[model samples]
Target: MDLNLKDKKALIFGSTGGIGRSIAEALIKEGASVYINGRTIEKCKAIAQEIGAAGFYAGDLTQKGIAANITGQMITDHKGIDILVTNTGGPKKGSFLEVDLEQWESDFQSLWLSVVESLQKALPAMSAQKFGRVLLITSLAAKEPLPGLTTSNGLRAGLAGLVRSISNEYAKDGITLNLILPGYTNTDRLKALNLSEEKVKEMIPAGRLGEPEELADLATFLASPKAGYITGQSIAIDGGVLKGH
Candidate 1:
């Protein structure tokens, strides 16, 4: 199916690796001109080169001014973003009691504030164009808490709340805001968790960890021109790991 994303410009954060990289590659394959971001210029450039249809931007989204600067640069080059994929690295695994104030603040800023900053810069142009797709990559933990992911559980829930409110406010203006929750996708991050592949398969009803391409395909659809009516929803691509409605 043609996503109608040919020539659409997308800016993807945390695209150096993992799920973010998957999304970047998928968008490029769908004919979108993508700008990939990472903390290091070399990594971003290397990935962009490998992906073939992407540009590279190296900036620390955790830094106060970096998000604005990247947004401004994208606008200057591409006029504005047609799609924005908000993503970042997950925080260190631990319980709430094990987290300190610094960890809390840092996680909040990286996981939530970075999205806020980028959207603030991109929303006006999106409104003016009368077309926009903002896809936030969150986790199932947002709705179903996990034992060792308190930071993600808390921050992603807040991010979903923000998406819900923004989707309502922006829907009338022809913009769609939504969140995509990816549960146990097969990526480097998941491998780092060190569960045996067989154990992962047993845990998920689908009997396997999800492929990055699977999540990326869904992200491409969400950002497609045909998906305009899907705003204000948090759809999970979790291989039935989340049984809740």
Candidate 2:
């Protein structure tokens, strides 16, 4: 399980905390050159230092042009990244009727459009090198819609479709695009929902919430050379919560 990830350059967005930070730590342990990204410079730099990342990128992906700007800066600094993990914070939780048009537009921009922009910026370098691993951190809502996550259910599912289409087009170029669906992971986002661990565990067959590192392990593998043949797949790490075929 060498992963053959040594010296590979990786860019992970939303790495200041939670699942993103866990993924960054895993990549660093696998000997990849990791870049920690967050909205604030100080936070990103602190996490980068803590995780021994190669560098850090600061920007808000929700804002216009930010994804392209971050990718451009990475290209200028490291030439280009071999792996790109597009991880973003989830939108506010609410029923479909509770969400407004503005919220939908905002969520679409941050969760969907920004990802497209980042890929557009990073793909050329990946194509030129004939190597790339794109791992998107979506959620179980993408597969089985959650009760209170209307926005995520819609946008993340859309992203899944986009990943499949792009993966087919890029597989010939030595690039693999895939989605990682994390279910009830023990992260800040989960904590913010004020969900009782006992209550949540009761719903999962595993009888426990997933650890961030659990998702990180899979992400590390997906972003490595070993996973070259895997593409356009939405793999869930939801502890049997998603009982769909």
Candidate 3:
């Protein structure tokens, strides 16, 4: 249970709220120094204060310069990051034919390409130290392809493929790259969708949506030394909602 994570540094994207913040809190609880990232400085600072002296990075990762800026700042402050949690907001809900080319490109940049940049920035240090945990917080839509989330479905699936390929390339370097697919978590975004809690619970086999902490716990474990053998996997934390193995 120690997780052996003390003193390790983590850079978690989209940490202003929801699952990303949950992951940051869990990492801090495990004694890891975490850099919480968000687009605005105020939100980042606020969350960092609430989470206890967390390092904060404010940037829009969808913009090319912002990723480098964040990585640069972190390196200057803490030398390098050991764990990278690549998480972001999902694309707008719409059918495949409804989404335009710009929407597709933007979604790819926000949800998938940002991970590529973050890894490129953080990998050298992790490889040099022979210690790294790269966990991409994806969605069950990557596999199940929900009707209203066609953009998310396509982009997240591509993200899964990217993670799979990199897991193979980096396993020998002591870097474990894996994807965590979550289903129906209770978050502000989900709440805003306006479905009754009971109605949502009925759809999932577990009879309830997953909690942010539940997904956070899985991410923490995957980022730990104990999960060294779990690379190249698309592990679903969907409470049996995902049917297939």
lDDT of 2 by residue, 3-53 (tens): 999999999999989999999999999999999889899999888998899
Off by over 4 Å in 1: none
lDDT of each: 0.87, 0.91, 0.84
| lDDT score at residue 216, model 2, on the 0-100 scale | 97
Write down the TM-score for model 3.
0.95
RMSD of each: 1.2, 0.9, 1.4
Regions more than 4 Å wrong, model 2? none
lDDT of 3 by residue, 18-61 (tens): 99999999999999999998889998998899997467888886
| Winner of 2 and 3 under TM-score | 2
Candidate 3 local Cα displacement, residue 31, angstroms: 0.6
lDDT of 2 at 168: 84
Candidates sorted on lDDT, descending: 2, 1, 3
Clashes of each: 0, 0, 0
